[model samples]
Target chain A: MRPLRRLVLAIPALWLFAFFLAPFALVAKISVSRPLVAQPPYEPVFSLADGWQGLWDKLSRLTLDAYALVFSDDLYLDAYLSSLRLAAIATLLTLLIGFPLAHAMTRAPRQWRTALVLLAIAPFWTSFLIRIYAWIMILKDEGLLNHALLSLGLIHAPLSIFATEAAVLIGIVYSYLPFMVLPLYTALEKQDPALLEAAADLGATPLRAFWRITCPLAWPGIFAGLLLVFIPAVGEFVIPDLLGGSDTLMIGRSLWNEFFENRDWPAASAVAIVLLAILIVPLVLHERQQVKERAA
Target chain B: MKRGLQPFHLAVLALGFGFLYVPIALLVLYSFNASRLVTVWGGFSTHWYEALLGNEALLASAFVSLRVALVSSVLATILGTMAAFALVRFGRFSGRTLFAGALYAPLVMPEVIIGLSLLLLFVGLGIDRGFWTIVAGHTTLGLCFVTVVVQARLATFDRSLEEAAMDLGATPLATFRAVTLPLIAPAMLAGCLLAFTLSLDDFVIASFTSGPGSTTLPMRIYAQVRLGVTPEVNAISTLLIGFVGFILLGAAAINRLRKPQGSG
Candidate 1:
């Protein structure tokens, strides 16, 4: 019975290994390959090709040119910084909005809690691209936002809102806010109310009790939600591509352009490899924490 | 003391909900506008929605997306449910932890990385990147979700019933089909629904895998979105949101019905 059980695990395990891990290993390998003159970017070295000259060519040819290209390029550097800045700000905004909203959902009448969660998650099921596009109609020059502001005499002219950094930030936060809310809500919901009462009884102010007791208790969920939003937001291509102008370059779009436009797979893979390296620490930590939670 | 609702909190709640819906609602409202300019309200008219009906390309993409979702979600549910059953019902093994980690790798791995890597894999293997490749990709991602949900359901399952069935001379497969299948049907259905939703909404992976002219609806919308917004896309957005809203309500109704009759 145990043997049969082990066999069942084997198939799925091997599937992930072959498809998931192997492909990533391939990316890392391709990132190190030599670039050719005219014939595409990559040229594999054959061991049986010939003499000392061939051996020297293969041995000396493992170049960091691709990685060097990514680093030296102004757009790539700017985009990387912008992606981080935008993602950081957006994750913070989501947390600010999500915390209170999630808290409200948890504290709401029990009958309404499920309804609120459904409401929050319903937008997620709708087409994500469409939702981002919807923001364009609202944020553009003659869009709904301008129309509203103008009609209310709040502004003299239509605001230049669309395709700006603000527009991208709003779109990203709007799109991923539900992801932030659900996990935080899960964490906040599990907090024992008695702990808060205990804090208050011990002469802590309500705000102090919340900061020390509630926040610490819910840190796991906060961290989960933060990582969840941050990681995706960093690699976010669509929202930034659509909503951001030349001023707001992002790493995802740079990677996209490298592959689709430049036809430089090695360079694209290099960018991706660096991204993977940067993300590996946070991702590993997140998974470890999740596993610990599951065990508990 | 009468605990009145805080006006500030009420205002915040109202604004938050407004932030969530106003853009989407504006999009829906403009879908009926007569003007080509998405922002301008040239009076109430359903011209774009009417135009959308005649757009063969949009319809074809929708069809492709539907087929992918249906096939992949079904495949994921079956494979995932079986794997979950094996993991829970069967005793622990040497590589159980490793197996569990491998199963979940797809779930949290960044979609951009997954898509690029998979595309690279297809290229390396000399496999054509198209609809079948997309279906394979979707199924792999969907399976992780299904496995997680089904494993949760199986965690609290009563094992004695299965033991008794075995003692009564029922074959393992027969016992599984007759007893276990009936017990975890809700979870199985939930897993399927979840898979369907994920596969339907997936854009990044599909964008990477889908060949030219095989654009999914999201992909089409994305292509349009880069240039500018259009009422046609807005109409599609409205339709999708409406469909999702209906599903959510139905799921809630089913959940309510499943609760005990005398709980009140």
Candidate 2:
């Protein structure tokens, strides 16, 4: 039994350690290095030039230039801020739209619950890029939405929605709506029906019962949904790049440009490390909360 | 309790479904457009599908993406099942906290960070970026999700059945292979499907790790979208959607047939 357990644990442990932990440490190490014109395009902060003392000298070779550059430049700052802002707004919007849909699912006939739940997840079965691309076709100036508006005589000019922050918001909300909805539905679905019935028997209005009973009970779902959407949205690249104009600067794009376009691997690592830094507190809190939940 | 959906709930659900489906519907409708322009529908035609058949680069990328998705998803599922088994069945082991943290961290870690970190690791190790790198990135990304899913199934499994088997003087390995494997096979299949879909849909990690002449389908589609949408894109997208929809529905049908009535 012991040998079997060891074998079961060893393969995955080694794999994740090598591919996951080591890479993350590499990010931290490389973020402190200077940009160079080489194959990997970054100077190694460590070297073995003259044995022990050479290693000490190699440590000194690492610089704070990348972190300093991020702080000094407004581009990186704005990218961080806008990513948070867009992600926050998108989270709120998805919650608003997703709440009703999830509520509707819980209220759906029990016989249809599986189908309804499947409906919520169906979009995900398609290629994510195509789903985002579909929005581009619908929101572009000469796209379907504008065409409908024009035919209805509601607008004389095409709406400039395709390459704007609003477009990015639309794409984010669209892509993540299921993430927001599924958890909320699960939370809502699991509520004891008798509790809501008891609330009703006490003469609470339906809306009041929802707020007083459903919302309070579903708080965990809301938090989970928010985390699901916000964390990924903040670092989302494909949606903003496809839907957003130059005005929409986000950390994901910043990291990509520094690595690929600007060829500054260290700078890109800095952006990612900082992005992770900003998110770590919330992430840690969430994890701690999960641990507590599991304990209870 | 109400016996049926309220009018208000129906309206909201209708609107939500419309929002979800309309864009996809439009894409399907335009796939057959005779006109090259996205908005202008000249007439119905299959020209774009024919063009898609002729696009060798796109075909090659799709093939690579398929092969990558297949290999990585299988590897991820195996690794993920092991992780799930260790976490659930084994008592606390050395480095449990670190192992658990490593498992959960990737769940919310941004693709940019994961991609960058892994790419740098590959470069640091002098491993050239290409097909193997994309598989490595995707396997890392999908491992957590598969574990989460398979762990859910493991949590609900009837453990005493395995216990009974073991009590009959069967070795743990024999018990697992003979009893547990068949029972959890459905969940494993589901987990594999999820890992496959995740690998297929990935763009950021794939883009970061992919090298010259190794473009995946998403990479190809993203490059083409930047140039502007053609009917060809819509045709290919519709086909992809159809293929995925078939898989999802088929999976659902299987689950429906197999599921016990009173439980989730």
Candidate 3:
């Protein structure tokens, strides 16, 4: 069994070594290689002295410029703060909305459980681009919401919604709500009814019982959902770009501009390396939990 | 007696579902609207869908997306399945954690960053940013998902059969080909399909890697959306939703078949 295991494991190791690790190593190497402009498109000009010294200079230079630019530029700083705030808000909203729906599905009259689950996952299965695009139709200046409101005499002017932070918020919340819900539902379904009943019998109010017993028991799932939504939300590109106005200069978009528009490899890699450092802890913890779950 | 759902729970559920479906439902409805302006509903017609079908650029982009998705998804799935087999079957190894982290890095790394870094790598290699560059990008991301799905199936599998086959003098390859492959084939297929969908739907990475002539469907749609959406986008979106809806239904059917009759 052990020897067979060794052989099986070798396959993935070789594959990863060739594709995954090599590509990232290449990214790091290219970040420092002098950008050659005259080759129709930019290419790396690698020289022996240039290789080591260039990496050091590029690394040091990229850190200062990118870091300074990200911090000193009020627009970039504001986009970062707003993005953080929105991702936090969206994750909370998803939990608030998802917990009840997940709870309802698990405890609902038997006939409705599958239907509710299907409904929850249905939107998720659709192309993410379409789902986000769907919001533009509903949230734009003369879009569905404004038209409906105007006809109903709610307001005279169309709401300025299309290119706003609020639209991005709505998009993020919608995109990730299912991610939050699925884990919560899985956790809630496995919960024992007796624990809740016991709390109630001990003279706890229903709310008290839920807060004290259900919440802690469901903490792992809640954390899983948080990691699922929050981490991706931090790095989200499509939602903010599509929904946010010119004011939104998220790190993702910032990185995009650096690579495509500015054609700066070192700067882009610096931003990515920083983002990776920020994301590593949560990702590591989540993977550990997943691995443990499977082992058990 | 236990209480049924409280009014608060009921309201939240209703509001959540309403939020999820209303925007999407409206898009599908408005796609058929005759008005070119998104805000006004001239009348119900399929002119936008007709326009979508008539547009050569849209069709070409869709073709490009399909081709990239098909090639990359197959490659990713094959590599992922092989890796999953190794991970589950192999008891322990030096630097396994490092290897696992590398494999899963693309999953947590923001797509924007991945796209940027990969683009830089390609440019540095003097490689032209085009269809194949996009394929490399998609495959990197797609493999993580494929590995996760296949790993899940492998964990649940009984390993004694493979051991038995090996003990009977059948080589490792023969045992795997005859026994293990048959058992995990469903999961492998599901993972591949999931990879295909993800690659097809990918926008961020594809946008960074692809040059002008190689735009994918999502890339084209994104460009249109950024320029302020028209109903033609709505029409394209409706078609995407329909296509994915069919795929999900098929997935659900397969999932149901995999379970035994007595199990919920």
Best by DockQ: 2
Indicate the worst ten consecutive residues by lDDT in candidate 2 chain A: A287-296
TM-score of each predicted structure versus truth: 0.90, 0.96, 0.89
Model 1 ranges off by over 4 Å: A1-3, A35-41, A45-62, B1-12, B86-92, B95-98, B167-169, B246-264
Worst 10 residues of 2 chain B by lDDT: B255-264
lDDT of 2 by residue, B1-264 (tens): 574599999999999988998889999999999999888889999999999998999999999999999999999999999998887778677887677778877877778888888888888888989999999999987787788778778878899999999899999779989889878778888888888888888888999899888899989999998988888889999988887778877987887776774244
Candidate 3 Cα outliers beyond 4 Å, as residue runs: A1-11, A14-19, A22-44, A47-75, B3-11, B161-175, B251-264
Candidate 2 displacement at residue B77 in angstroms: 0.6
- Decreasing lDDT order of the candidates: 2, 1, 3
Better of 1 and 2 by lDDT: 2
CAPRI class assigned to model 2: medium
For model 2, the stretches where C-alpha displacement exceeds 4 angstroms are: A45-50, A289-296, B1-3, B252-264
Candidate 3 local lDDT, residue B33: 85
What is the C-alpha lDDT profile of model 3 across A21-70, one tens digit per residue? 66666565544444445552333445466778796664554224445554
Instruction: Kindly list the per-residue Cα lDDT of model 1 for residues B1-264, writing each as its tens digit.
Output: 112235554566567667787777777887888888875679988788888899999899989988998998898888788778766766666666666676665666667788888887877776877888888788888888888888888988888989899999999889988778877877887888788878888888998888866788788777776667777877877777777678766876886676564234
Angstrom error of the Cα, residue B24, model 1: value is 2.3
In Å, residue B147's CA in model 1 sits off its true spot by 2.3
Q: What share of the true interface contacts does each candidate keep?
A: 0.46, 0.75, 0.60
- The per-model DockQ list reads 0.49, 0.70, 0.55
